[model samples]
Target: MMNGNALHTLKALDPAGGSQVHASPTDRERLLANVLNTSRPAPGPAAGLLRRWRWPLAGVAVATSLAVAVSTYTLFGPNAQPAQAMTPPPLRYAPGSESPRAVLERLAVVALKDTSRVPAGSSLYLKHQGWALSTRIGQIQVTSAIVPSERETWKKADGSMRWKQRTLPPRFQNAHDEEVWSDAGAVGEDPQFTEDATGPVNANDPLNRPAPEEPRAMGKWLLASQEYAGTAEAFDSVAAHNLDELWNGRQRAAMLRFLATRTDVTYRGKVTDRAGRAGQAVSVDSAYGGLPTKYTLILDESNGKVLAYEEELTTTAGALNVKVPSVISYFCFLTARVD
Candidate 1:
């Protein structure tokens, strides 16, 4: 999605992981307003440690504000200090001789013949393990960090959906990043309560809508979908990024067909994803969120299901405090199926 909206939704990510800090509704509203209203620094040749990545963090705020019926916590308010910046290692891709179009076309063939289906009235289920660089440019201190988590979601055709995410110990690019996290007691020690969220979501949200199973139909869907969907790479990457939505084999095939048409993608040959599963890679480069980023998608070599989606810096971190050539985010699909 928007790289500026770093850490994806940050819906279930919190560096202030420990006990829940209970606060009155007024206090929570006040904190949310204060944090969201905080001025974010500009990127590229600009002055300041970047926190624009937290733009999506504001999106998350609206979610929790869905009538106080969602969730509430006074996490990393302006008064709180950010201890360290998260710098995760970049992905290592293996080379390939074939064209990305050839790889995608081949995968589409496989998806078309597959029989994976979700019963009409039942929900589609998907589970993934992912991590993203999270930086909260709070008033006190700038914090950049990563939190690993396993997330699972269920969505019905009617747009009813719910998701749960649990903290997983994170990995860092260097020892110092780890030290900063440890010193601040920011280990994954169960800081997320999004682990308990459920259905009755904002079904009208474009992302929660089920994508059609044909390229032409999906194109129309995208045209009417979010503004970002206007960009092929953005929409494709977002589909692979948010496993929260549903699509059967046919739909996945349609996605591949559409992707095959994008000339910007390059075939990266074969690679083992974070799940240690063999996969075929296709990548596209974007200066998303002002950081020159390489977005890679790995497909299961056997059936063409998405295995992982990753984003890392290609040249520099831009306005962010993280080092160049570091991974900004990654998600590995450990389980995905209609159940």
Candidate 2:
């Protein structure tokens, strides 16, 4: 939901429908200063002196008065009224015509193929089941893990990589519970294998586990393009994938079975551009089963990828607003390639 201030900012951007005009901070500051100076009264001593020098004072006073009037008009005149509400431009892509799944599948293929472009000693950002994991390649072994709160970058003789985990605090424990991997093998013992009753484990616990045989792909096969006026079939494909990924994990067969039993999928359409992309828009919503369990999917028209996904689990008995049952959100990039 957008508040008044946020709406005002959005209006000012004139996103999609209007041109982007950037004003330098220095110019803005100078303009603001001039406006302020014009609005203020002359010093008392200056005014007294000006009265003695009537002719010169009158000329100065006229100039000052004119400046003040202009400033006042600029600040409080017709232009000061709220900007007109602009209608958003129509969407660029048509629904059902584009195959979001095929696009994503291609994107995933391209991403996997391009993994070799990552320098032998460099790193890449990977998201897994709500966890932000990072992987770095080394001379002998690749290192990867769910980054700890205290550390931001890991350095070795060959190179270094920076990473920050963005999961909610309560979810970090669950991330640590899952196995962290890199391309080489498991880097360290699984954190869940160790127990800590008195205090959290020390650095010796080895945050960098061996890389998994296959790194979890992020920014792949996103729903990039869709026709807004089309049917729900394209949206349904994305929702299906999101639900499976959100719940199935490594168990594909079991996940399929779990998905088969679910029904009551719903879609709501709203015209809006995809975040961070121009000329792309979507009408998206959620499908839910019972309370606290729902899958939210967004049909992205810009790049033809599902731009966002969220799964929430809520309990009716818990705190109303504070509790988050379970969730994930996706933001895909245009440069992001699919298979």
Candidate 3:
């Protein structure tokens, strides 16, 4: 059974009701199969993970069409490789010799040096491709599905924007342990919402429109706008993403300056994002509704752009006896906005 809060938040995020479609049997099977096949664990890995960490997962589950909730997925392929052969490659950047604070402080200086300007008649175009692991009811036992997804957003200074998101079918295994593609209402390929400049702006909506160019001003506006209304950390994550999306050097510098003033923000040294891109990592930790949460941003040093956004749980509250440090959601935001 879905918790009331999660259901409510999901509805709030999907006001267009795009994910409510019923799936045909054929579609459901295909989606489940994709999820399962893409998520098989290597030999001995699951047992090792389960034994090493045990924690309860709890809290208010927030669902946005862009909600990057975290779930576990075993990485495997069609031809299973031996555990010894599955080692990850070395990180491109070595862990910073200096503290995270010093690194970010230096990066802040680099950002202030940015003189890049936006092109005329250009609009912000952002494309994000990521995966989400979410729950679904199968024929017998409930299982999780990994849905490959995409989101595209175009915006201009006038607050005119069109947002589209599509989640491809997921792969999962049914009660019979047969891999299937799940078409449960969880899968959809369409624009959830789109608006032109004339569309009404909700003062409370963080994604309502373009943001202020100055960081202090942006911070003030964010507070009043409740753009990151979920938690202080949540606010930071949203603020970081939006500032990066603006693609303005001045605004980006201001964002770093604004963040410098916050006590909760911390520099997390060098870390790689989901896309295997290496960058400096900064994170914010806070409690939302008594649940501990954290959000991390991996930033490209050359351009100071945010390479990724990551959210994870700090504690195992209501989890099914899972381990801590689990990812809740993440996105590798790629922006080449003009104008």
Task: Name the best candidate (by TM-score).
Answer: 1
Query: Candidate 3, overall lDDT?
Result: 0.49
- Across 1-339, the per-residue lDDT of candidate 3 in tens digits comes to 568589787767876567775888899999999988874321121111112112212244433211221222212222221111111122233445665556656666777678877765456776665432232112111123344445566766444566554544544435422222222233222222222223434646654435556767766654543324333643443433452256566666665666666766677777777576778877777655244667677777866666776656577434322235555445666655663
Off by over 4 Å in 1: 1-84, 135-146, 172-177, 190-192, 196-209, 223-232, 235-242
Which residue ranges in model 2 land beyond 4 Å of their true spot? 1-101, 109-116, 123-274, 278-319, 322-339
**Global local distance difference test of model 2:** 0.28
TM-score for model 1?
Answer: 0.67
Better of 1 and 3 by lDDT: 1
Q: Can you rank all candidates by TM-score, best first?
A: 1, 3, 2
lDDT of each: 0.58, 0.28, 0.49
12-94: candidate 1 lDDT, tens digit per residue: 47666646777888999999999999865311100101112112221232112211211111144433223224455655678
Candidate 3 C-alpha error for residue 204, in Å: 12
The positional error of residue 113 in candidate 3, measured at the CA in angstroms, is: 3.1
What is the TM-score (0 to 1) of candidate 2?
0.23
Candidate with best lDDT = 1
Q: Which ten residues in a row are the worst by lDDT in model 3?
A: 80-89
Candidate 1, residue 274: lDDT? 82
